[model samples]
Target chain A: MKSLLKKKCHRAGLIVVFAIAVFLGPAHGYAKAETAEAKSECITCHTDVKKLIRLGWKIEKTRPKPGKSAETAGKG
Target chain B: MEPYEKIYVKPSFLKTNHGKIGCEVCHNGDTKDPDWQTAHKGIIKDPTFPDADKTCGECHEDITSTAKNSLHYTLAPFGGVIKARANKKDKRVFEKVCQAKEKHCSACHSSCGQCHVSRPDYVAGGFLAGHLFQEKPCMDTTCASCHGGRVYAEFTGANDEYPADVHHDKEEMTCMDCHTGKEMHADATGVASRFDLPERPRCEKCHPDVVSKKPKTSSHAIHRNKVACQVCHAVANKNCFNCHAGTDKKGLPYFKSNETRMLFKIGLNPNKTKDRPYNYVVLRHPPADPRLFDFYIKDGLSDFNKLPTWKLDTPHNIQRITPQNKTCNNCHGNVSLFLQKNDVTDWEQKANAGVVVPQAKIPKPLKEISPKWKP
Candidate 1:
């Protein structure tokens, strides 16, 4: 009876571990890239996933001031 | 000038790798040399014209060759019809007729840029999305702009008499959904007609049960080999008549067509080609006269009737449950819908050779037949 209880406990522990892996697997797979180069490489192949990075960078360089319209910012 | 005309304002895709390169690289104009007239000098309107290899080939080599060889680019059907109708005896007259068609009808040729970017030239083309590249082509500007007057109109129920195709009306399926990219980039061969193309879209492709040798119902089993699907499914379609040819003030060739009653008629298949062996099929009157080429050369299309004016056609209007499927009596004895002797005039009788069904050949009604009309 003690051996039977041990077996039951082992089975329950296995089920719990399996359930945790199944739930957390996708989150681990989709963990953020470690570097900028890795992120850029991912975007290159999956271009449809997001607006291109170059567009954002250019807007950062040329975009108007926080309180001003682009036309007014250009004139200023 | 509009901000779109300035060139660098493009889609995000164009801002990547080779796309980062400016438009002037392919378009070839004097953007750097800024004398107003000089800036516009040597500018290529369509980089994909004449040879797509110079531009589109840089990225898509496989598609470029297939697209170049396609019927839309070659306009092979028009060329085939011209050759078939031309008088074989007089070489000079045939040459002149071909020249006229090349000058006028050839304006509708499809190119890479036409489908992927701008509209066709005939419809006054410009950049469709303020100069952004479109991955999925716009169906209206790309396909319907060319096919609008007849096929598109019929499919969309632009004609008040008929309802739209069940695929389009209920499911909202577009043309490209069925007509695959392989069909657009056809096998590298010149086909005389759209019917002759090996990859032509068919009802059987989608509705496998409809064409099965052993069908679900008795009527389908009986009619499997004898009748075409369109004969049962198609509704009244716009038929063109009395087409007049004239030259515009700019000396450009133009033609006008007048549409007749919207009706369905089953006639003998004009071309009994291997692909279409059925004796009965839906007939369409393409807007062509015996004297279509008269403006260019007298007696040019003298042998026009050599090829039938009433063509075997599958019109866009299709329904799963048509009136013909209602009962055995609907079509089994409906002689009016079948091409009859009196249907063709004396002048056109020769052209409509096998189309006119003999009164005796029509199937006898199953039971005690009530005579619907006086024969």
Candidate 2:
């Protein structure tokens, strides 16, 4: 019983750590995603997406292609 | 001299006189330093200074007199129609039409640098040094600012419709030609103290030729007769149509009689048609002779009944009755017929031949008409 209680307490500690990471870690990440979307809209005409990203715009993921790509095939 | 001897002698004298008094009593060290000669050169024994009025009014007492009589001081200082317009929300726009500065008497009456120092372009630097008599820009741009086109054209001779002999052009007169400090104030108040009337020489300054050739007795004669020069030669009305063509009450053009216009052009007003106090003589008519009476009819007995007729001489054009010379009784018949008609009075019969012919002795009047008569 003592071993089981100790195991349950360890699992609870992992869940709390996971919840804190999900809540705090993605706060800036979500802002970065929103910024990237806004930047993409600006870069369609500008063609200098890298300069905007260096100027504090966080670009995360681009639109995926329908055809096979190395990164998409790896994800699959 | 030895140093001890000089110091002892001066120190003894200073100790005897000044040791009893404070150091500054003799030296004035507290109030002013004796060694500061350059800074204390103009230091006064008494430190009191007169007020601004006493300092300025000493030299500018005459300015006070001039300002009292000046139009700018008398008329402008008190608020009037022009001042009311100047202090408005749209002051900049209103300044384009009326002068905003001239509304106050203090603007002109104050010391020179008060108004003129900033406007160096208008008044030269002498104004800042309190020289009020220096030339100013009043007649030029300053007057033109508010007076605008009217005064500008007058001074520049843009409106030269006046006759060639007009005084304005002859004298090269500016806006100050007729108006001065005194006369301008005369408009508001009934009385003014200053009068600077220009003499005849001022007019002769431009009209030298007219003045030299002027009759010696002209002025005296005019004065004796109480006649003004404007009576004969003056602009009756500025607009030609006003006098010649007539105008409505508002000075609008209207039709006028040609006869009336012609008479007015000759210095006669047709409306006032009373005869002038002058003389007119008529010559007498020439004598009527018998030769000119060819159209007369004769009525009498026998050949005497022929109408009396006359023939006219070509050159002299004299009219005479009867052929050349015939006796008196050749046409005369009974005397009663001459008395019956009584056409010719005694005076007429006497004056006929330059002789007093008696009425009863004259020939009888013609009775029956005859076709053989000359008439």
Candidate 1: where are CA atoms >4 Å away?
Answer: A1-76, B1-13, B16-18, B368-375
Candidate closest to the true structure, highest lDDT = 1
Which interface RMSD values do the candidates have, in the order shown?
Answer: 20.3, 51.1
lDDT of 1 by residue, B101-145 (tens): 776578788878877777766565656654566666777767888
lDDT for B45 in candidate 1 is 77
Q: Over all chains combined, what TM-score does candidate 1 have? A: 0.76
Clashes (N, CA, C under 3 Å) per candidate? 0, 19
Query: Which TM-score values does chain B get in all models?
Result: 0.89, 0.26
**Residue B303, model 1, lDDT:** 72
TM-score of 2: 0.24
